[model samples]
Target: MIGDMHPGDILGEYHEEVIQLYGLGPRKVLVTEREAPYPDGRLIVSRTDTDGIITHVNRSFVEMSGYTEAELVGAPHSILRHPDMPRAAFKDLWETIEAGKIWQGYVKNLRKDGGFYWVKATVIPNVRNGEIVGYTSVRRKPDRRKVEECIPLYASMKAKEEEEVAQ
Candidate 1:
């Protein structure tokens, strides 16, 4: 499945430098105390290759991410990863989606301007001709109650990850 999806198919017009930048840049950026306001009825969508390079994004995704179309198209999805999000959560998400399964979770995403927002996200593998070519993700404004419930769980997971890394 991974072989079926060529980087050129997902990375149209972008050069290898773009992919290298994704793998080399600062994994975490400025973190602001402010939060990005999420309005109701908005959905953010994006598509990425198996390697997680963003291929396409909807208007909502651009607006919510506080990044322009040009900025996001060639960047890794992790450009919006919030520090509060645990690495283990992403590990699980990648594992699930790579296995051709749908992965859903509450995600706290960082905006380009250093603000943050929470979303209920569902990521599905895009299979063509019996092989996965890419992935599609749909995110909507998260329920406040669910966000509250996940806060402690994610915090605990983050701590565990830190402990393991320290060991």
Candidate 2:
């Protein structure tokens, strides 16, 4: 599970010279299957355009969501958005990714049966030749303690954003 992972637990931590050379670098953590059992947390990989339309989703993603690939391929990714999730958080996510940067955080997603699950997600902008082409995200099960801490924050943020939007 991703929650069980600490920053120090990452394998093959290395410095990227390109990032240092360009002064636009962030320290990278390389994870190997040997280091962790292929991340037991359910993984969902997707590509979305600037407008947040769903373009693609992996098989696991479709299975986990209880939606067939055909049903989800063209639907908005927001189709799975949980009402408990804060709109502000997603807003922040979009803003961060749109800037061509990565955003790492915990998210609570609703399944087809309305059951909720937690994931530690790292969202990165898919850039091509310095252009923001789209976005990709990798998510894994989050630690229970971390999810506990995030719930209230998300609830509060959701309430505030919903109130604002309602006005």
On residues 64-130, what C-alpha lDDT tens digit does candidate 1 reach at each position?
A: 8877888888777887777788877888899999999999999998776666799999999999999
- How many clashes (backbone atoms < 3 Å, residues ≥3 apart in a chain or on different chains) does model 1 have? 0
Model number with the top lDDT? 1
Q: TM-score of predicted model 1?
A: 0.83
TM-score of decoy 2: 0.70
Worst ten in a row by lDDT for model 2: 15-24
Q: Cα lDDT for residue 124, model 1?
A: 100
Candidate 2 CA-lDDT value: 0.62
